[model samples]
Target chain A: MTDEKDFLSGYDPGDFPAFAVTADVVLLTMRAGRLCVLLIERGGPPFKGMWAFPGGFVKLDENLDQAASRELQEETGISGIDLTQFASYGDPDRDPRMRVVTVSYLAVVPDLPSPQASTDAAKARFWPVDDVEGTLAFDHDRILGDALSHLRTVVEYSPLAASFCEREFTVADLRRVYESIWGVDLDPSNFQRKVLGIDDFLVPTDRQSSSSAGGGRPARLYRLGKVSELRPPILPPD
Target chain B: MTDEKDFLSGYDPGDFPAFAVTADVVLLTMRAGRLCVLLIERGGPPFKGMWAFPGGFVKLDENLDQAASRELQEETGISGIDLTQFASYGDPDRDPRMRVVTVSYLAVVPDLPSPQASTDAAKARFWPVDDVEGTLAFDHDRILGDALSHLRTVVEYSPLAASFCEREFTVADLRRVYESIWGVDLDPSNFQRKVLGIDDFLVPTDRQSSSSAGGGRPARLYRLGKVSELRPPILPPD
Candidate 1:
């Protein structure tokens, strides 16, 4: 054992346990009115042929955020979307090979093009979140559950639900983002009233969305508001 | 580079990242009407003599939770308290010694005895949360801030604030937990009403706390109720 004099100078890093750190991104979006997540199939061993959240090991030179971005672009062909560092999973047996800890990231994207798989992925595509089964390659089933719960909780107080909508959208569009994610039918009038009651929750735009066919009235468009926080946050029903 | 045939056969885990994983526990407890966090002074580099959250490297045989428990006991000698995994920090430049990613855990312990520094620490003690300047080594200050914010938010809905108190405590005790953490004053009557209004928040105990001196009154003692969720969460004052 080294004394204070030999502590820093003769310290051997190998004396401590070695662990690999990876990043997993849970990219959620709405397609055909159903919530979906981006997933990839591994081209190589360990969990080859099984579906997993798009991810890879972090590089020595890169930060966790940069690694998440690079992996997102490599696996899903999506970039510039806001990614939040959600949580970390470090269960020793999570990885079959050895000790591996993964930092999980979450993002809600608008309508996106089909994803293309590269690097270690055999294929990449958007799969409906409701259709997800326990066959996920790792602890991803648990990770996805955590991400969904966070989404449910935060969407109430934040403009997070709007991230799944177009730049200029209607109250109906925003409501659908909540309805689809929570998998519950929100009373249209009450949700509209509650959202409007929240100060600066949304800003009314001059233009209105075109109403199709039967000639109902075109709904007014609203943009994301400047208010950062919801004081009395809108919460999901008990 | 190995071909598909040789990929599985020749895969070397060391070919990728070689990061050392660590568990940092942010143990918070109220001492003398103030919120305090347990910290340790390092005896060796890379940041010797500076204060840091009680933490150390994960051992090969121990899981992350076990590492956190061991590190906490080694640094502060406080055990049997529940520690929750909150987040992970993996910024490349976080640790100057080597590539290390740490999972941060949040623990709320009741009034504890003075801590004894063991293992790698020179000294261990609880420092008031408000007194913590950015003088913390590594990104511990940021991690501490995140834990405090999470605490302030969750204590309203979750039974988190109670974790800082002994069993069968006064409403004043619970209110002090909020006041200390949020650093705000709660109107006594309104606070009591709101807390009691939350169904099953507390169950009255037959015992009453002894009145300190004069004739104010002995506060009622209550135990935690079975209700798991707080429907309408209590919000901090604006």
Candidate 2:
């Protein structure tokens, strides 16, 4: 056996540990009345070839938001999507070889598109919330859970739920976004009143859906309103 | 003259790149009639002897919350307070020595005795939200601003505001917590209807205040309800 002191002395650096900081993107979009997130394949060692959230090591000079935006654009080939910082993760064993802390961001896109891998990855694809079956790399499973909870909470008081809808969507369309994410069937009449009553929550548009799935007087389409308050806040399911 | 390789090779043994992580405590409590935060004095190097939010380094194998709690307990003799992870800060140059990432926590307490110094060379004290006069050390001022905004948003929908009041309180007393934090006078009738209509926001108690400040009937006292939802959420001032 090798001498213990020799081995220990060889490994000792005697300085404060260096940690690699990175940003991960949880780009969310509504697809088929469900929430979907973009996932990327890792090409590098240390969880190589496993599905992971889109992210990269933050550069020395970039801010956290800028790093997140850059990673999103590079990994997903999408730009100009509104991204909000969600949470940060820093478990010592999160990365096996090094200490890595990742700041997670939530991006709500208007439409779902096939993602192209741009950085250190094998491939990029959009996975439906229902289809995210297996374990995700790193501590991403926890991060996604936190992001979803934040999204549901935000939708109650803020107009962010509208971001998941198209430029001009009917009230029913808006309600679907809430119902799917919250996993609750809303009272149609009450939902209509609650959404329309909020001034900034939606804005009436001079547009209507070409496809009349719910036959009647063609439903009038409205965009996200300018008013922010949802007078009577939307309560989550008991 | 030192060569490039030699210059790089002369890494200081004491100056190893340490993962600089900070713990910021959003110590919140109701003072007089408004919400306030606790601040502390720094007695260590690298901003030695400056006033800052009470926090410290994250030990290996500990989660961020554990670190925050440990710091809170060490700095102040307080323990078992309800604390929530609020946000994380990871600016490259937030610390002078190296890149420091901070996980900030929001803690709610019901008027405890003043905090005593427990860890580091620091003194702990409480300050009102409106009285954060000048710049705080290490971008703490920005962190405080974000924490306040989060508190405002959280109090509107969550049952957190009641944490500031006693176990049993009046509708008027609860309303004052909102008014004090938001810094605006609320219409008693509208406020009462909004809070009472919500199921379980507050529970009716058989006890009433024995002495009224003025004439009129002694208003009924009620304990915080089991239900957490503030149905028609109390909105912040425009």
Residues A1-238 of candidate 1: C-alpha lDDT, one tens digit per residue = 1232222223676656788888889999999899988886666667777778877788888988998888787665678989888889878788777788899999998877544433344466778987885677778899999999989988876788889988898998888888888888888789888888888878998999999679878988998887777767877766
User: What TM-score does each prediction get for chain A alone?
Assistant: 0.88, 0.86
Q: lDDT per residue, candidate 1, B26-56, as tens digits? A: 9989999999888867667777877888777
Q: Worst ten-residue run, lDDT, model 1 chain B?
A: B1-10
> Highest TM-score among the candidates is held by which one?
1
Give per-residue CA lDDT, model 2, range A105-168, as digits (tens). Answer: 8988866543444433346677887677456777888888899989988877678888887788
Model 1, residue A152: what's the lDDT? 90
Each model's fraction of native contacts: 0.45, 0.20
Screening candidate 1 with a backbone cut-off below 3 angstroms (N, C-alpha, C), the clashing residue pairs are none
Global CA lDDT computed for model 2: 0.72
Report the TM-score of candidate 1, chain B only.
0.89
Best by DockQ: 1
lDDT of candidate 2 at residue A199, scale 0 to 100: 64
Off by over 4 Å in 2: A1-17, A43-49, A113-122, A187-190, A212-221, A235-238, B1-19, B43-50, B115-122, B168-170, B187-197, B203-225, B236-238
Docking class of 2: incorrect
